[model samples]
Target chain A: TQLLEQSPQFLSIQEGENLTVYCNSSSVFSSLQWYRQEPGEGPVLLVTVVTGGEVKKLKRLTFQFGDARKDSSLHITAAQPGDTGLYLCALGGNEKLTFGTGTRLTIIP
Target chain B: DVKVTQSSRYLVKRTGEKVFLECVQDMDHENMFWYRQDPGLGLRLIYFSYDVKMKEKGDIPEGYSVSREKKERFSLILESASTNQTSMYLCASWGQNNYGYTFGSGTRLTVV
Candidate 1:
């Protein structure tokens, strides 16, 4: 089974602070995706990175796939209260997705 | 936007009772998946169906069963609810393009 581990299971920061969460794996993945989940709701896709060393930006969030395709990271710039949610990373191939443990982020005012 | 709907948002059942969780997708996706989310275990796939009446067991399928009678609807069944089975159950569907899986709001089940 493919397993993805995420660091800093819980994070708390003041608004305007920058934070980065890392997702690491021993096995390589064909593609990786980032998702944000609000309380009592399913996760929403944030971005997907398919190529090694590829980086994609969505507004204040930036996602990068590692050069070995075995890791990824999500960086949030100037975090806001709205960014307080659970962040999940998923790796996909062959039509199945393996999700990470997830990071719970809280941005304080 | 793709829409996935689950029958119940919250459910409470007693131990040894049979429970059913239903999921439906409006996008006519070919693949539907059932997952359970725990505090530190993340989302673990319980079962998945690639087509009508065809099913595959995922990582954690020991205490669960799934039924897919039609293309758009999939159901997860617990033969006998247990306290260990209490968790947030999620449903997701994916189209042929493999763009991404769209998830439903999820059902929080409590077995007491």
Candidate 2:
């Protein structure tokens, strides 16, 4: 079974601070996706990175795929109270998508 | 816009009772998935269907079953609901594109 592990399971930072979350796995993935989920609701897709060393920026959030395709990272700049939520990394291939243990972010105002 | 609809928003059932969670997609997606989300476990795949009447067990499928009678609909069944089975059930669908998945609002189930 393939497993993805995320670091710093819980994060609490003040508004306007910056933070980064990492997702690591031993198995290489063909593509990786990032999602943000609010409480009591389903997750919404933020971005998808396919190539190694590829980086995609969505407004204040930047997502990068590892050079080996075995890891990924999500970096948020100038975080605000609205950024408080759970971040998830998913690897997709062969008609199946495996999700990593999420990173919960709390932004203090 | 693509839409994946889950039948229930919140459900409470007694232990040992049978439960059914229904999901439908308006985009006529060929692939549908069922996942359960816990506090630290993230979203664990329970079952997925690629076509009508065809199903595959996901990472965690011991106590769960699924049925896809039509192309746009997928149903997840819990033979016997238990306390451990209580979680937020999510439904997702994907088309030919590999961009991302479309998820439903989610159904929160509580087993008493």
Q: Specify the highest-lDDT model's number.
A: 1
TM-scores of chain A across candidates = 0.97, 0.97
The iRMS of the candidates, in order, is 1.1, 1.2
Which regions of candidate 2 fall more than 4 Å away from where they truly are?
none
In the range A46-67, model 1's lDDT, one tens digit per residue, is 8888999999999999899999
Computed on C-alphas against the true complex, the DockQ of each candidate is 0.75, 0.76
Model 1 global lDDT (CA atoms, 0 to 1) = 0.94
Shift of residue B81 alpha carbon in model 2, Å: 1.3
Question: Any runs in candidate 1 off by more than 4 Å, and if so which?
Answer: none
Tens-place lDDT per residue, model 2, B1-112, is 7799999999999999999999999997889999999887889999998889999999899999999999999999999999999899999998886478889999999999
For model 1 chain A, give the 10-residue run with minimal summed lDDT.
Answer: A89-98
Tens-digit per-residue lDDT, A1-109, candidate 2: 7889998899999999999999998798889999999998889999988999999999999999999999999999999999999999999774788998899999999
